[model samples]
Target: EETDFEKTIVDSLNIGFIPNFLNSFLDVLSTASIGLFSVLFISFFFLKDSNLLQSGILAFVSSDSEKRTVHSIDKINNLLSRYFVGLLLQIFILFVIYTITLFIVGIENAIVIAFLCALFNIIPYIGPIIGAVIMVVLTMTSNLGMDFSTVILPKAGYVLIGLAVGQLIDNFFSQPLIFSNSVKSHPLEIFLIIIIAGLLFGVVGMVVAVPGYTAIKVILKEFLSENKLVKSLTKSL
Candidate 1:
């Protein structure tokens, strides 16, 4: 019965599936490569001549607000630098924990798997779930051709538990500390901002939420210090 069901499903798949998938993959790869090169080129120039970039940006500001704008830019730079460094630290912590967990579970290529999974955690909100899925799939596949119920299931379950533990540490300890120290926002505040940004602008919005929110808060405080809401929100900055 199971063999018949499997064969039926296989037969139902479109004959062009493999070719279509290859075409789509190549298209995506080309797009990604172009985007990556563009970003790197721009970023190289920006970093190499940041003062020139800053001067160009400040050229649009009125003389009256020039000083304030400069201050806001500096503040934003400092906060974002710290936030990015904190992210690196977070990834490192996750890598260490994941490597240890995978090693204990006897998974093959544990270091590489842990590193890839750790990198995925950079995406806000949804990244960890994606990482967990990848980890479990990799763990199970490491024992390919083994007995599924006795070996693969138990190993995958252990990997899942380890992922939960790592995430708990990240949630309860790492993230809160990073948010408070680097961005000067509460975890709940950041969480709500990410969710709202995700709803309004999708994954890109969520990815940029923390640094974007921090920049906005800095600008608001610099320009609208007297407004009650702005004052309340920017008090942390």
Candidate 2:
């Protein structure tokens, strides 16, 4: 029965797997392409006409707090813009590092794989783990017929080491600098916020944690200027 089951799987793969995989991949790619263009257009509109968002938001502000609200909004906009640009640079740096490592290991389609994996790093704590798993799976599959113990394991190990280096730089250097300079928060504060947000609200929470936290800090500083904790947190802002 086991042999028969194995044969059935092999038959399915031989008959339909490649085409099915390609079709599914194309579907995902098309959707992602559409999302990418939509995001670009929206970002361009917001960046070009920044006051449109400000005006819309300010409509809800009380007349007494209007001046303070406008100041907070300006600070939020500047900080978030820097934060996002820093994130893009971080991903690009990882992509370059991963590409170099994959090329050195002679991995096929290194650039595309590296870029995809690098993009995964945007998700915070869990992102790198997912990227590493995908990287290892792709690396092994790229050399499917090779000896698993000798060729595949060693190559995957090399890629893992490369990933570790990229992660170290991101965690220690890139992240701290981005958080401090862009958002005016301690690395530890941002890390804790991201973890707590992830636990409570999942991946989406983690993705928005920094921006949300930064906005909150800005608001708190504006309204609670006399509070000691708020003063400490937002002093750098």
Candidate 3:
């Protein structure tokens, strides 16, 4: 299964995406074996360590900033813990979020549809979009998967609203709390970085853009920040 998956990845890689894809695939393989669980766990770890490195750096600053950094780190740890545990609650939460959304928007079978999408949310960038695509396809293809229009409308509405709100919350709040608070890049800057990543390596690149950039930033801060040439260049520039 792993070999086949890797072959498919390698086979599909275009000349431009090949290098980035190779780097990402190798990094993923090194951290853990090729599987959904391993990949997801590594993604979660990337989110966690990104903050840990920042808090560690804060230790180098003056007393007050360092102290606040401590508080921030604690808050971050709490956030990571909550996010980590959220997996268990995902099904219930997705059902509720989507069910309510459908009820308001007038779709039916909200609970069932949303439960499925919650599963997809586990996959990062591809997940939510896929969920929507599946939902819409089902909407068009299937017979409401129910008897009553009222029930069906609420069900469908729930998925759409649930997904929209969930995505919005993630984009505006959860993402910063998890993957981005550590990086401190502005929204515009982050957008530009995503655009660059997308241009270079497609959807997966865009999704992992923030973390990859954060990782590079952390490495530079930790190792290159003190280099004589870096200091001279900084002063000169």
Candidate 4:
């Protein structure tokens, strides 16, 4: 169904975005190399306009059933603001760690790879894995499957180590900072949510699936049945 929908849309538009996506890869790597300043500038310009944020928050908290909607909005805004701050900090930390590791490993094009890894790290679990996979494939394929001990092995090893340590930081600190007090679904549920979203809306949907699921769950918890069964069915860390 989604394939059909996507095809129809593409056919109607007579456009393919695959090249657009691929063509932007170099530009993306270049932007990443600019370090924390670029990301901070982006967040500041796009997200720091408090007026739009306030209005959006007001609309969400003022859902049809809310009574103390205004108060709720304030609290929710506070929580989200804190989460946003923490997310930026986490990204910065990951960027610094990867960049330092790259330097330590003496990889020639390490800055570009580290930047790519840091940028991709924004997506949490899948992001790091994807980055690691890409690096491994590049290491293997670029050298024509050369002897690992001579050329590819050390690079792949450091990339994996960098990803592993980054994941630890993400799980231990970032998840708690971001998902606390939100609807924390079980791992299976999260996986299913991603699959369903991918089926329905493709790559973009999969990217946003978990957070979207969390929003839906939060709404259900607040307004739907407040039953033990519902809570148990949805519970997870």
Clashes of each: 0, 0, 17, 0
- Per-residue CA lDDT of candidate 4, range 1-237, in tens? 479889988779944786896667655444433433444454464346755765666676645655544443444444445555666677777777777776765655666776666666655345675567666555556555567787677776876787788779877776565556443455566568878876786445554565456545544455554678657754542
Query: What lDDT does the true structure give each of the candidates?
Result: 0.81, 0.84, 0.58, 0.60
Writing each residue's lDDT as its tens digit, candidate 2 over 1-237 gives: 469889888777755677897687566444444544454466557656879988998899889999999899888888888988898889999999999999999998999999988887877876787678778889989989999899999999999999999999998888887887899888889889989987897666777788889989999999999999988998988
Candidate 1, backbone clash total:
0
Candidate 1 lDDT, 41-81, residue by residue in tens: 55356446768877998889899999999898889778877
Q: 127-217 in candidate 3: lDDT tens per residue?
A: 6666676665555345455655665555555556667887776666655554433455556666788788767865556545655565455
Residue pairs in steric clash, candidate 4? none
Report the Cα lDDT for candidate 1: 0.81
TM-score of each: 0.81, 0.80, 0.47, 0.56
Tell me the spans in candidate 3 whose CA falls farther than 4 Å from its real position.
1-38, 44-95, 102-116, 119-127, 139-158, 226-237
174, model 2: CA deviation in Å?
0.8
Q: Which candidate has the top score in lDDT?
A: 2
CA lDDT of 100 in candidate 4?
A: 76
Q: How much lDDT does candidate 2 score?
A: 0.84
Error of 1 at 138 (Å): 0.9
